[model samples]
Target: MITVRCFAQIREILGCDTRELLPAHTPQCAADLLKVIAGARTADLPKPLLVAINCEHASLTSPVKDGDEVAFFPPVSGG
Candidate 1:
């Protein structure tokens, strides 16, 4: 299973902070994981998402492997 985590506004939007997706769900990449979580809310995402795989920033195209930890959230900006 792939561990998928939601943060900040993303957690609020998705109504959960973390979840596990199975391969049978077709979460082969970060993008696929997003599809699994977003589902009907795909178009409702507040902003572009930032993805991290196993604690390293990665692109949505990054492949997901078993036991990998994936995180999704919005871009952060600061002064």
Candidate 2:
């Protein structure tokens, strides 16, 4: 299983903080896994959210494995 977390506005939008995805096979990368999660929650999610793994910023191609913890959040803004 892969652990996925949603934070901030993303958490509010999705109405959940976390989920466990049982991939048929390990995903090749974080983005791929994101797609799976998005597909599962299509009714509640907006497009183009930011994602991270283990509290570090990550890109679409960031590799992921079973038991890895991934997080997603809306884009941050600052002055």
Candidate 3:
């Protein structure tokens, strides 16, 4: 199982800080996992968000390995 963490508005929306997913196959990259999660939670999420893997910012295609921690958050705004 891989660990997925949610932060900021994402955490509030999901109502949980973390989640576990069992990928059918080893995800080639972070993008792959995002697709899975997005599809799974489509009903709950309607907007785009940012994702990080292992505390590092990553693109959708970023590779993901077993036991990696993935975090999701909304875009930041500043005045």
What TM-score goes with each of the models? 0.87, 0.71, 0.68
Predictions in order: lDDT: 0.87, 0.77, 0.72
* Cand. 2 Cα-lDDT: 0.77
Model 3 TM-score on a 0 to 1 scale:
0.68
In terms of lDDT, which candidate is strongest?
Answer: 1
Best by TM-score: 1
Arrange candidates by lDDT, descending: 1, 2, 3
Q: Model 3, range 1-79, lDDT digits (tens) per residue?
A: 7898877876776677877987556436765665566566645753676778888878666777878898877776769
**Candidate 1 per-residue lDDT over residues 1-79, each given as its tens digit:** 7899999888998898999877654448888889889899978887678999999999899999888999998997769
TM for candidate 1 is: 0.87
**Lowest summed lDDT over 10 consecutive residues: which window, candidate 2?**
38-47
For residue 22, model 3's alpha carbon misses the true position, in angstroms, by 2.2
- What lDDT score is found at residue 37 in candidate 1? 91
Q: What is candidate 2's lDDT per residue for 1-79, written digit by digit as tens?
A: 8899988877886677889987556447877776676766755666577778888888768888787888888787869
Clashing pairs in 2: none
Q: What is the lDDT of candidate 1?
A: 0.87
Query: Any residue pairs clashing in model 3, and if so which?
Result: 29-62, 29-63, 30-62, 31-60
**For model 2, what is the alpha-carbon lDDT of residue 14?**
67
**TM-score-superior candidate, 1 or 3:** 1
